[model samples]
Target: MEFYLFNLIRWILNIYYYILIARILMSWVPGMERTPIGGILYRLTEPYLSPFRRIIPPISFGGMGLDLSPIVAFLAYSFLEGGIFTVLRSLFHWVG
Candidate 1:
């Protein structure tokens, strides 16, 4: 049914959102990227984030730079999730 399909896709996207959060948190720890979990997170999130990185270069503070790609990626993901759910709701005649 469309209801179940919509929930399933929503659940998957929610999991991906959590994965992105985990990846962001993992970056704070030194050498975290070398670990297996970190590697998995990197593989899952990098493709989604790389284009944002290309579009927006990091902010430079003398030698150390602050990467804003993840923040941009999060905002973009929120919009994308909203749009997908909107289309799905219309297709399913969802009331809420």
Candidate 2:
């Protein structure tokens, strides 16, 4: 039971981590609004991202554009999910 819970937690973290990356990358590419699949991906990602937009605006490079907030969020989450978890695991020696 404990093992299953650990696995579930890890899976959720990785999924969200990847989703955040995917959504940010998708923004750089064109045609996300034109296709159905792309639209759905945009919809799934936008709700979480929209709130951050106001807090952290996108960067502009000449005519091109980039958003660094999602990358920042991913790095932050990675530390919490990966680094912090490792630290806690070592500190407590709780899991095998």
Best by TM-score: 1
Cα RMSDs, all models: 1.2, 3.4
Which consecutive 10 residues in model 1 have the weakest lDDT in total?
A: 87-96
- Compute each candidate's TM-score over C-alphas: 0.92, 0.68
Residue range 1-96, candidate 1, lDDT tens digits: 888888899999999999999999998899999999999999999999999999999898789788999998999999999999999999889956
lDDT per residue for candidate 2 within 33-93, as digits (tens), equals 5578668767777776676666788789787666777766665566788775676567666
What is candidate 1's local distance difference test score? 0.94
Stretches of model 1 off by over 4 angstroms after superposition: none
TM-score of 2: 0.68
Q: Residue 54 of model 1: what lDDT? A: 99
Worst 10 residues of 2 by lDDT: 84-93
Cα displacement (angstroms), candidate 1, residue 13, comes to 0.9
lDDT at position 64, candidate 1: 78
